[model samples]
Target: MDQAIQGKIEEALKGLFTAVSMLQDAYPGKPFTPDGRLVGDIGEVVASLAYELTLNEGLTKHHDAVTDDGRNVQIKTTFGTSLTFPVHHVPDYYLGIRMNRDGSFEEIYNGPGHLIQAQLSGRKATKTGLHGGLMAMLKRINQQVPDSERIPKR
Candidate 1:
């Protein structure tokens, strides 16, 4: 089920990336790249029976999509099932896409901030230490750049 959900999320992100890429291509030097960074969920659930059952449960996933050009996207997914009782609920899948300088790609689910940062930095996170390194890099970037400049100043 996880694999299937991952596939669906990936597909959705690809479509979004393509549209964004087109806009970037149409306007060169406008600071556009498929490798751009984004955070947060594209969608959120206002009300859910699952929350009622799980005692106000909430979830968010970042980096749900990436373009072939190295753009990164965050996605939030919600699962809805036609059945109730016995607690049968579909899982909401979040995807984070990272493109390597070597042209490789990695998609992560339910990742931490450091892990996502590593991906954005063209590093593959295979160990806990690597995650720490990624976090450090992210901290540095955050400190160096103002919030307004972080995302195209718009």
Candidate 2:
């Protein structure tokens, strides 16, 4: 990873968490977690920088960015465990990561979308993808992907 870009991410995450901590401290019982679109957006930004991808204009549905070689990629990030893949909308590539509170992250999955699609298919369709299925299979699935197939980090 680029130290400069990682530093920027750490700075931004620190500030955001500091604010969330203050809010949580105010309400002693409730927890204030940074999730949803914020995490998704952060993942997209980090993935774009790390993989040197070109982010698509607006919300382009299934894919978020185009790789250097022009393959469409769907980026996924989670502060917690598991990601909900849209079964109906698989892209050319899929990148999944987990973000920690300290602004660090782990690449959970990165490979062809078919890998994920196979894991999520033949299940009940709902507004959300991968309900009870495929949650525990990411690491196992990611392992099958050869490193050469992944986009090289910048």
Candidate 3:
């Protein structure tokens, strides 16, 4: 990562935190959290930089970015404890990350798309609320992936 670009991103993140704090102070107990599309956008930006992905145009089908080696990837990001991938299409690979407060992120899952999907199969969220698999579960699945199968960052 370029230091100049990284420094700018860090500054922008600080500004975002400031805004979130201000909203919380003003609203008092009302949740003015950034999630859904906004959080997704942030995830894309972070993925493109940290993982060196070439981001696709707005809302492309299946995958969001392509790797340097031409692998299609669906990037998932969450600020909360869990992430839910869309049921429609799983890309060639999956990269799941958790955004931290300090503008850094923790990679939760980086492995084949099918593997992650397999974990979600036939489990009704309401049965035990499996609708959204938790991060801890994802982490365990991630361990099953071999390093050679993971997308390598340059």
User: Highest TM-score among the candidates is held by which one?
Assistant: 3
Candidate 1 residue spans exceeding 4 A from truth = 32-38, 42-154
TM-score of 3: 0.88
lDDT of model 2 at residue 86? 74
Model 1 clash number: 8
lDDT minimum window of 10 residues, candidate 2: 127-136
List the global CA lDDT of all models. 0.32, 0.81, 0.80
What tens-digit string does per-residue lDDT give for candidate 3 at 87-134? 655669989899886667888988888887787776544543224755
Top model by lDDT, which number? Answer: 2
lDDT by residue (1-154, candidate 1, tens digit) is: 1345446655766776677668889987674433312322322111111111111224423333332324343332222111111112122222322332222233223322333343355434343322222323433344544332222200
Higher-TM-score candidate of 2 and 3: 3
- Candidates arranged by TM-score, highest first: 3, 2, 1
After superposition on all C-alphas, the RMSD of every candidate to the true structure, in Å, is 17.9, 2.0, 2.8
Error of 3 at 108 (Å): 0.2
Identify the superior model by lDDT, candidate 1 or candidate 2: 2
Candidate 2 residue-wise lDDT, 1-154, digit = tens: 6788789989989899899889998997977877789999999888877786889987887889988888889888888886767755677898988888766778888889888778667677786554433446877888889988786687
- Candidate 3, superposed: residue stretches over 4 Å from native: 125-131
Return the TM-score for each candidate structure: 0.29, 0.87, 0.88
The deviation in Å at residue 28 for candidate 1 is 1.0
